[model samples]
Target: MTKKVVYLHGFASSSQSEKAVLTSAFFARYYPHIDYAALDLPYAPDAALALIRQHIGQTTEVALIGSSLGGFLATCIAEQLGCRACLINPAVAPHKVLHQHLGRYYHPVLQQHYEVTAEHMSVLEQLMPMTLKQPQNYLLLLQSGDEVLDYRLALDYYQGASIKLSEGGDHSYVGFAAELETIANFCQLA
Candidate 1:
């Protein structure tokens, strides 16, 4: 059967992100049969979820690759769809983490502006899986040098899952290209 991998970019990020571009290129070059989609998600949490679901349509057995906020969204989607997901430097409890940064936010890459509100946090909280029902379906990737978020949070949160903790990398996940094969294997793209 054919496979599909939907990539979700992090908060304030676009499909043009380095990781997203690399992911698309890797799949295109090596796994030509696999459908790879990196969508530009809306800043609004609810709208983003809606767009992801709409893109997924009725397709079953889809795989997900989510970075940062995308990782958080991937977890929610995977739980609901019972699919495998590769989370890279995923945000843990973003509802709590983003509380301090609540206000108007802008992304220069997308030339978009959006509000960061308590309601968005509430939506995130509701989407969060109190406990992952199928932990084996997830692959958590973390780096120690993430300045934006503490990597330990993901380590503690994603316990009981397959995790690869690297020594040093920023929030953007340095050397991410090297892991493309591993991610593809985990998602059964091969």
Candidate 2:
């Protein structure tokens, strides 16, 4: 049985994200047997899901690690696939939150320009799970100082799941490397 782990980056982000790169390296160095991939998801939510599906075809032993909006997508995929996931500073309700930020934007890291529209928010709303079917399958990592998002939302949304809260960390979840071991154990990488 081949175990796999996929790292999903956040909105307007890419596989080259710092966290994604670190995770890929960590998995490569420590868990050589488990296959690991961090793909650059498309800008659109639907396309992103499609890309993830295409990449993960027929893979049984899989775990997901998602950040921000990627965490939202990972939750949706994890529920559909019945896999475990680790959410880092996840966006609990990006549809409602991002509604105000609808406009053209540029990502320096991705070197791409994209637009956020009402349709995108609609798709995100559709992806939102009304209720968690398997809360035990989720590991929530939250920080108090996330300027971009309100961490309490994740705390409330993922009420029954295992949570690790940190103080004074930014939206990027400062000191993310410290949680790799816990993430590995939760995802059952061994």
Candidate 3:
């Protein structure tokens, strides 16, 4: 069967992120048959999850790749959809992590602005998976030098899953290019 990969962007990020772009290019160059989509995720976690879930419903053999906040969302969706997920420095507890940004937020790269109200934080709290549902369905790529999130959180959270812990890389997942092929293989995009 043909495969699909849904890429979720980080908080305040869009489909224009470097990782999203690289993911798209990787599919275009090496796996033209795969249906690759990178979404311009909304600021509201509820809306973003709804949108991605909608896409998953229409796609074939759906798999997921989520970065940062996207990873958190992907985990929630993967739990619901029973699909595989690849998380890139994903948020462990976004409800707590995002509490700091519970106001106006802007994205310099996408030049977009949005708000994260207390209600949105509540949605995150409600949606985050309390316990591991499908541990075997996850593939984590963590960077120790992530300035945004503590890598150990993900390491501990996804201890039983397949994890790629890099020595030093920022939250942006520097050197993500090197792992594209491996990620593709893991997601069965190859």
| CA deviation > 4 Å runs, candidate 2 | 106-112
Report the CA-based lDDT of candidate 2 relative to the real structure.
0.90
Which ten residues in a row are the worst by lDDT in model 1? 105-114
- Enumerate residue pairs that collide in model 3: none
Number of residue pairs clashing in candidate 1, backbone atoms closer than 3 angstroms, sequence gap of 3 or more or interchain: 0
Give the range of the ten consecutive residues with the poorest summed lDDT in model 2.
105-114
- Go through the candidates in order and give each one's C-alpha lDDT: 0.90, 0.90, 0.87
After best superposition, candidate 3 residue 176: deviation in angstroms? 0.2
User: Candidate 2, after superposition: displacement of residue 43 in Å?
Assistant: 1.4
TM-scores across all candidates? 0.94, 0.94, 0.93
Q: What lDDT would candidate 1 get against the real structure?
A: 0.90
Model 1 CA deviation exceeding 4 Å by range: 108-110
